[model samples]
Target: MKIAVDAMGGDYAPEEVVLGAIEAVKSYSLDVVLVGDTNKIKEVLNRYGAKDNSHLSIVHASQVIDMGEHPAQAIRKKKDASIVVATQLVKDGACDAVVAPGSTGAAVTAALLGLGRIKGIERPCIATPIPSKKGITVLLDSGANANSKPKHLVEGAIMGSHYAKYILGVDKPTVGLLNIGEEASKGNELAQATYPLLEKLKTISFYGNVEGRDIPKGTVDVVVCDGFVGNVILKFGEGMAMFIIRLVKDTIKSSGFIAKLGALAVYPALRTLKKRLDFTEYGGAPLLGVDGSFIICHGSSKAKAIKNAIRVAGELAQQDVVGHIRKSIEEEEVEQYDSEN
Candidate 1:
């Protein structure tokens, strides 16, 4: 499969993105259409001795959307921005998928405007994979629509379940609605209203209500919530992981020689743990409910994260994730949910 990558849309810009695309082409045996300023992209391509690689090509997009800019405004004004152009390639069918390792807002906006939403989907959501004790838990609406209604959360649950099945290889993924209590009567109006709708669905395995702790424990395969709550959980978890890693390092350095020697004994295990906690290992989050495949990586992602994100884009394209989600929406179960409208 071929993928479009935003070469000028990350914190490291063309350098990290270009290198990652080059590595992804070699590693995944996929064609890459690098969208950005041609000269800037080529400089990195040539510097890495991949100037004539057959699997790689360039598409010029003169503009870029900065992280601080308004997503919808910048997308409309900067029509030729790198992220927009890359997403356009997917929309136009020149590329099978789009990978954006840049501003999440810009990436989401570009997908919504360029790719449009799938049939029966009111809002497209981000389905992010988080590491857990049992395995990975899929969280939806991570940063898509901050203020979502019950219907939106229902749609996200359907999309998230299909994503876990097709991409994550879960046969019948169990889905949970995030709330204050496990009882169906608990939570605000949204959760209370959504619980019954999710329970009535035959397409997915609904796991009642799940509290915050259930997420890290992997109590369910998928967690559906509003983007506001999901985004807060994501950021807080990331911050906590980094803080713990730093604390361990600082304590090790400040300890005595005996402690240092003891630490050497567990260095291998510690290294393994670090790799598991690394966001790069998870690749990136998939923006579901859109018409096409799009993967959004961390803005600070370097070479490894970008490469994996490209791989994820290819896998989603190969699996026809968008097709599966559309089919799920068209199923009789989803029609029942829509009957309320």
Candidate 2:
């Protein structure tokens, strides 16, 4: 498979991006097209002794969408932006998938405008894999549409279910509506309206409403929520994880030498836990409902994160996630939005 990477999108652009692509090329049996300034990409490649490698190539994109710019407006104005060009490569079938470590808004806009949505999909959702006690739980509408309808949440469940089946390797993935209470009568109007719709779907394994604590507890394989709530939960989890880590360190320092020795004794286990908590290990989140494969990595991604993102991009392409989602939508006869506009 061939992957198009937005080499200029991340905090450590071109340099770290190129380094990660090179690592991916070496590790995986895939070709990579680095989309960015021709000279900068080539320099990074040459610096890392990855120059002139047949498995890697470059597509010169002159523009970049900065963090401060509006996503849709920048995409319309900057025709040669790295993220736009990379996404276009997927649309044009020049590459199997596109990986962008840029602003989430930019990535989503580029994908929507460049690739368009699959037939029967309204607003495309970001299906992010969150590590849980049992395993990985797929969280959809992670930040795509701030406000969504019951039908939209149902679509997310279908997409998230298929994702869990194919990518996460679950035999029968159970879905849960993210709400304040486990009962169908709880939550705001959106949750109450969405409950019956999800429970009625035979295509997916719906597990009724699940509270916020159930997310980390791994009560269900997939959690469905509108982008607004999902985004808040995602950010909160990230902050809480860091806070716990810092608290642990502070306590260790404040404790006596015996505590330090105990920490040293369990250093191997601590490193293992750290690896599990690292965001890079999960690669990037897949922007589902798009006609083509699109992976969005964190803006602060480095070599390891970028490398893993590329790996995920390739896997999604190879598995034909878009095709699966389209087929599921067709079979289910889900409602379609005015995609042309």
Candidate 3:
């Protein structure tokens, strides 16, 4: 499948992005269309020995939308920008998915305005995969929408559940509502109203309420929350992951001789922990409820992260995630929102 990548949209720009796209094409045998300044992209590709890759093609765009620019306004003005052109590839059916390690706000705006939303999906939830005790948990509405109603929370749950089952390959994924308490009567008006809505969905394996502390425990396969709360939880999880890594590094350095030997003995365990804690391990978050699969990678992502983002794009294409979500949302009569102003 062909995936469109915004080559100019990142902190590292064409250099790192182009190299990552090359790696993806070489490793996955998937066709890639790099949207950016053609000469610059080719220059990077040649450096990586990927300039002659038959599966790769460069689509030239003159302008690049800056990270600070308003998403809607910039997309309109910068018609030939990497982000706009790359997203158009998906909208025009020239590519199966779009991947970018750019401004999260801009990516969200492009997906909403360019590709449109599914009929029954009010808001397109950002599904951020977090490592859990069991495996991984899908957190929905992770900074997509800061404010939402009870219906929106329930919609997020359904989307998160489907994502876990299809993408994460979890059988009968359990849904958890992130809340103040585990009790059913807990949470604000939104959570209280959503509690019953979640119960009505036969397709989802509802697991009742889950607190913030339960996230790392893998209390459930999917955690649902409004964008405002979900964003806070996502940032907190990321921050804690970094903190734990630093602590491990310090512990390894300060240990005595015997303790250093012990550290060596547990080196394998530490490696495993590091991999789990790495945000790039999950590749990127999929912008669910959009017409096509659009992945949002971390702004600070490096070559490895970009490569993995392509894999994520291809996998979503293979699974037809957008189609599945559309069908599920329609069948369940889920309430959707107008993403455009």
Best by lDDT: 1
Task: State how far residue 174 of model 2 sits from its true place (Å).
Answer: 0.9
TM-score of each: 0.96, 0.96, 0.94
**lDDT of residue 41 for candidate 2:** 93
Q: Please write out the lDDT profile of model 1 over residues 1-341, one tens digit for every residue.
A: 99999999879999999999999999987999999999999999999999999999999999999989998899999999999999999988999999998889899889999999998888899999998998899998898988888878888999999889988899999999999998999998888888988887778899999999999899999999999999999999888988997888779868989888878886787788888877667889999989999999988989889899999899999999899888878883454445233
Model 3, runs deviating above 4 Å: 261-271, 336-341
- For model 1, the local distance difference test gives 0.90
TM-score pick, better of 1 and 3: 1
Better of 1 and 2 by lDDT: 1
Ranking by lDDT: 1, 2, 3
Decreasing TM-score order of the candidates:
2, 1, 3
* Model 2: per-residue Cα lDDT over 1-341, one tens digit each: 99999999979998999999999999999999999999999988999888989999999999999989999999999999999999989889999999999799999999999999999888899988887999888888899999888889988999999889888889999999999997889999989988887887778999999999888889999999999999988888887877887788778867999989887876677677777776557988999999999999999999989999999999999999889888888877776422221
Give the number of colliding residue pairs in candidate 1.
Answer: 0
lDDT of each: 0.90, 0.90, 0.86
